[model samples]
Target: MFKVLMIEDDALIGDMVKMFLKEEGFIVTRKTNGADGIEALSRFNPDLILLDWVLPDMDGLSVCREIRRVSQVPIMIVSMKNKVAERVDALVAGADDFMSKPFSMHELIARANALIRRSKLSIGTDADFNAPTLSVSAIAAAPVSAMKPAASVEVPAEEKIRLDVNTRSMRVHGKHVDTTYSEFEIMKCFVNHPGRVYSREDLLQTVRGIDSFVTERAIDVHIANLRKKIEDNPKEPKWIRTVWGVGYKFIPM
Candidate 1:
């Protein structure tokens, strides 16, 4: 189920919206103030956020800024301020979208779902990405290699990380890029969807089967290993930069 963090001070509205969203198939966490909403991040790890502009303790814009500092989770500002300037300000403060007050519960749910869907795909944009899914049955049948190995074959090299899926071998910068099975598949995903961000959850789901119990840290470890091989300066990675508070994205030249 998709998780949502809502920061709304209006008790009646907050309660009603939370109940409505729950009915729409979301695990909702409601916070009355910005500070509590900020603290909820560690606990909730929401896929999307619905922030009210005015909060009892602090402005919601600060919450947006703070969340954006560490994560690229989708944020939508729901406010009484209907001006274009207010919407632009919210976006400038790192919100992905905006909704004026007096919104339908159904519309709110639809927008929340849309944001979560977009966040999973990359971050802000919403282009349909058919990220290949690994089946649990396939995982159980095969070793944890993530991909089956095959005999080597000759092929022309691309200007980027070239993966010969049949053999599952890879090449980068005209040289054979040595990689383990998991690393090769990860690279294949990145190269296939260059410029798209993949959160740890995303990488975990795509690289491993959705039903797999792999921890998020395992994704980080694998990424570190891959960066060491691919980046000239892993500390200052060029090809795969960390989108703080987000995940990783392949930067194509």
Candidate 2:
């Protein structure tokens, strides 16, 4: 079973979330304060974390940053702060995903499952198998010899784009890039359609998977982070270029 560490101060909300997750077959551990939350990290060794933005002892962002210093586990921020800036801050602080207050339980479950699926794929595990030639009974069942040498494969000279949607992971220009779940979704959208100039509203709706709780500036922030990871110099980006008064486009380089 997948283990989840949930740091929530509100008892009712905590219990509700925990119960729901447990019903979904996840091992849920709850902590009421940031200090205890951080302390539980080592003991739980959780596969994922559901962190609240405001905790009694410490802010969730700081906890996220500290945890990221030592671990790469997926973190989903459950916060009431719905501002675009706050969301960007959470992402910058190392949260893999974010959910605003009063969110649907279904949406929360979907996001959590997405993170877990992506995490499994990042470790080279195939969660789904459809190939007739390959039987994936387990992640361990896939032989290393059957894997393709992706690093050595020559990306087309036109523009190189790499994506592993299952993991929400990406690499550009031969360098591994760290991205939040939303940012990865945005990048994946652009990579799938290079040279397309997408308006901020379009990108926000497409990447966020919902039309609510996002702003144009939020899209800009995600683009900036993507540039930092994919560009040789963020100040003068080549892959994702600005469109002056318009929006942004992937230059496919």
Q: What C-alpha lDDT, on a 0 to 100 scale, does residue 102 get in candidate 2?
A: 89
Model 2 over residues 87-148: C-alpha lDDT tens digits?
A: 87987787867899888988888888777776675445654432111111211233445443
For model 1, residues 17-111, the per-residue Cα lDDT tens digits are 88988888889999999989999998889888899999999999998888866665677788889876666566556565677888777677776
Count clashes in each candidate, considering only residues at least 3 apart in sequence or on different chains.
3, 0
Off by over 4 Å in 2: 35-47, 67-74, 100-107, 110-175, 210-212
Task: Evaluate all candidate structures by whole-model CA lDDT and list the values in order.
Answer: 0.69, 0.73
Question: What is candidate 2's TM-score against the reference?
Answer: 0.66
lDDT of 1 at 205: 66
